[model samples]
Target: MGAQKIVRQEADTVGENPLRLEKEKAEQIVDALNTDLADAYVLYHQLHKHHWNVEGAEHLGVHEFLEEAYEDVEDAADELAERVQTLGGVPHASMTALSEAATVEPEDEDVYDVRTSFENDIEMYGSIMESYREHIELAENLGDHATGELLRQHLLELEEHVHVMDHYLEDDSLVQS
Candidate 1:
């Protein structure tokens, strides 16, 4: 052998590390977090798309609100991915992976109406909240306090977004009768 090449595998790739939690428990938590991360990413992109495409008298307001909402969601996605890495797991890297793992479905590109976008957002937020609660409980049960806390924080932010969207839906001015 004229030259020998050494291939290096990362902790995540090899699934070998000095994590204190049981490997199974860590994997479980990571899997849950990854799913949540996927949902967050999908929601973020949906919100951004709606922000740009939203049309009606309240278009400016809805666009600004969606911008803020998506920003928060982006932060949540980053934190979730970081938590997965901290737990000695690899976060999903591809759009296909994120889309496949996500529980929240994206709206069709043709659906650009403001009212429909808000309605879809509210529904998506509800689904994400449910997933967050489930993951939080699972993390707690598994003694992954860090993951639990991270999800709890995301839950609060998502709840705020839902509240805002609900208020918008309640606005009579926006409703067509």
Candidate 2:
């Protein structure tokens, strides 16, 4: 057999949750979370790309920071996937599903200077952070306090990285042109 199907939980459908949330509300939370999960993966890949291509002054520091940022995004995506499962929903696993669900736009495949890369990263992080804020409100509104709290924690780190990058982009840097 190629692969016999069993225990199917379609991505669009919600099953029973131990927390006893209403199916409709649970579905809303699932949709928001899946978007967050997709955005995190996109951020992870873009940051990884920047990490690989970074150059110029402070290249080592920028490269290392990109790795750290992407790792954090990867961890966040894992948590989001698990949270979807906990809420009795199937997480978006296919690249197409994720891309469809994602609200954040990633940079194109072309490599750029570290400044341009950080600028793009900052933009991506801003969108994800904004979505997290909205999702946190949605989760709390639906009495999914745990999910809200999870995104809140992630937001703090996201802000911290943006702050550091803002400093990096300050005009006091050693660039001649």
Q: In the order shown, what is each candidate's alpha-carbon RMSD?
A: 3.4, 1.4
Model 1 lDDT, full chain set: 0.85
Model 1 agreement with the true structure over 2-97: per-residue lDDT tens digits: 788675534233254365888788888888988999999989989999988887777788889999999999999999988888787888879888
Q: Give the distance in Å from residue 57's predicted Cα in candidate 2 to where it truly belongs.
A: 2.5
- Candidate 2 lDDT score at position 125: 90
Best by TM-score: 2
Write the residue-wise lDDT of candidate 2 on 115-144 in tens digits.
888899899999989999999999999999
For every model shown, the clashing-pair count is 0, 0
What's the lDDT of the predicted structure labeled candidate 2? 0.91
**Candidate 1 — which pairs collide?**
none
Poorest 10 consecutive residues of model 2 by lDDT? 4-13
Candidate 2 Cα deviation (angstroms), residue 70: 0.2
The alpha-carbon root-mean-square deviation between model 2 and the true structure, to one decimal in Å, is 1.4
